[model samples]
Target: MSTEYKGPLSVETRKIAKDELREDDNSRAQALRQMRDWIEKNPKIISCRTDDSFLLRFLRFKKFSVPMAQEAMERYILLRQTVKIAFHNLDHTLPKMAHLIDNGYLFAVPGRDKLGRRWIIGRPGVFDPYKFINEDMCRVHGIVYETLMEDEENQVRGFVHYADGAGVSLPYLTLFTPKEAVRIVKNGERTLPMRHKEVHVINVPSSLKYVLDWGMTLISDKIKKRVKIYTTAEEAANNLDVSMLPKEYGGTIPMSEMIESFKKELVASRQQLMDNDNMEVRLELFSVQAKEGAVSALKSGNQSCNPYKTDVLTGSFRKLEVD
Candidate 1:
C-alpha cells in the first residue's frame, strides 16, 4: 500500500556540491573523500555504505574534510519545511497580479544591493515581485488555486514539464496577468517582458528568435513586422529587450565579436592555464554560467526567460469561470 510519507527531504536546496571543484583540491573534488575520511575517523550517523559514492546522492553537501552531511541534511529539511515562511509576505507584497509587468516571480540580480540579497532572503534576489490577482499566499493556510480556471481570485496554479529533455515538473504558484497572456499569444513559448512606459518589448536570446519571430505574428497588435535585434547593451536598452546578434548583423554583443574578445583573453588565460595548468578553470566557467542563471530565474514580471511554465499534470485541476 502507498503510504503518505511525511518523511524528510532527500536533497538540500542550499547545499550545493562545490563552489568550484579543482583537480588538485581533493577535498572539493568528490564526496567520496569526505565520506571515507569521516568513516575512518568514525561517524555516529553512518552505519553502512560508509564510503560509497551512491550514498552521496542520498545526503546533503558538507565540509570537504569530514562528513558534515548530517548537519547539511538537517539544514535541507529545515529549509524545505520553512520555504513557506518566506512566502508569508506574498500577500503584503503582490497585492495585484493582473497588471504586473514581470509576473512577480523572485529573481536574483547581481550587485543590486549593498549587503547582498537573494530572491527569498537568505536565498537570492527576485525581480517583478507579486502575490496574486486578489490574494496573498505567504502562509500554508492561504487559499490554494486551480489552473485552467480564471476565478475572480485569479490564483493560477499549474505544472510545467521540463525542457532540455529533463524529466521533471515545475509547479507554479501565482496570479495570471494580461502581459503574460499577450506574450503567450505572440510567442509560442513564454518570454521575459522588458517594459518601457506603456510599450512592451521582450528580450530573447538569438538562438530563440526563430520561434519568437513567428510567435509574435498572432500577438494582439497586427503590426508584426520585425523582431528588432539590438547590437549593444546601450542599443538593447533602447529596445528594452537584449539579445545576442551575429557580428555581421550588428546587434547585442555578437557571438563572433565575443569570440574575438575571447581570442585576446584566451591567449592570456591559455598561458596561465599552462603555467598553473589547472583543469578546473575551464569547469569554473561552466559553473559561473549556472550560478548566474539562478539570479535571472527569480526576477518578477519578466516577459521571457521568466517563469512561463509548460508543465502538465496527470489531469489538470480546473474551476469553472464566469464569462
Candidate 2:
C-alpha cells in the first residue's frame, strides 16, 4: 500500500477508508481521472487544482462517489465565487488575520480524540466584532478548515468542532443577519466537503444560547442531531477527553502552546491560501440558471423554502434535509 500510494495515509486510517469510505487504489485513481476530465471539460471552471491530493479531499468526503464528488466540487466553486467576503484576500500574514490567530479565534487541537477525529476549538468571543466583521471570522474559519483538509487522516477521520461561548456578547450575535446566518450554515453543510462528526458548544450564556437556538433551526437534521450544548466547562469535560484539551477546559495542553502551533501551521499554509484566490466560477451561468429556476417555480406555483426571510423566525423553523 505504501509503494502504491505516496500520500499521508497511515495503516489504520487506510483500513478505515477501505472498509468505510470504499477507497482502494483503483477506485481512487479512477475517481481522480474522472474528476480531472470533468474539470478539463467544464468551461466555467476557469481554474482549479487537479492534483491527486486535492481531488482526494472531495472524493473521500463523498465516499468515492464520482457523481457526488462532482456536485460537491461544483458547489465548492460556486461558494468561492459567491462568498466573496470569505474567499477574498486569503492571506494569513495580514495583520487582522494574524491578530485573530494570535488570540486563537478558531484553531485545531494538537492531537486527535479517541475516535481519531480532530477537535477544532472555536472562541468567537476573542475577536471584537467592530474590528473584525463576521466575514473576517468566516475567512479565518475557511483558512483553518482548508489547511486541515490537506491531511488525509482528517479527511477520513472527520472533525469535531468545540465552541467556547463564554465571552460572546450580544453585539457578536447581532453581527449575523438572518441571510448571513443561513448562508453560513448552508455553506458548512452542503458546500464544504468535510466530515463534520459533531459540534459541542460549552459555557454558553442565556443570550448566546437564544441566538444559537435560532441558528440551529437553519442546519440539516443530521447536523442538528450532532450539535450538543452544555452550560458549563465541567459538564462538557465529562463528555469529552480532558487529556486532549487545554487546561482552561480541564485538559493538559496549554492554550498558549496550541495557539502558537496553529499559528505556525497558518504560516506554512500561507502560499496555498494565496493561490486559492484564483479558484473561481463564471457567475453569469449561475445567474441565468437561477432566473430560469425562479420562472419555472412561478409557473408551477411551487413556493421554495427561503430560510433567509425575516418571517422565518416567527414560526417553526423548517429543517433542511441533508443530501
Runs of candidate 1 with Cα error greater than 4 angstroms are 1-19, 22-69, 82-104, 107-323
User: Please, what is the whole-model Cα lDDT of each candidate in the order they appear?
Assistant: 0.27, 0.77
TM-score against truth, every candidate: 0.21, 0.87
lDDT of 1: 0.27
TM-score of 2: 0.87
For residues 57-113, could you state the per-residue lDDT of candidate 2 as single tens digits? 899988999999988887787777677677767777778888898887888898788
TM-score of 1: 0.21
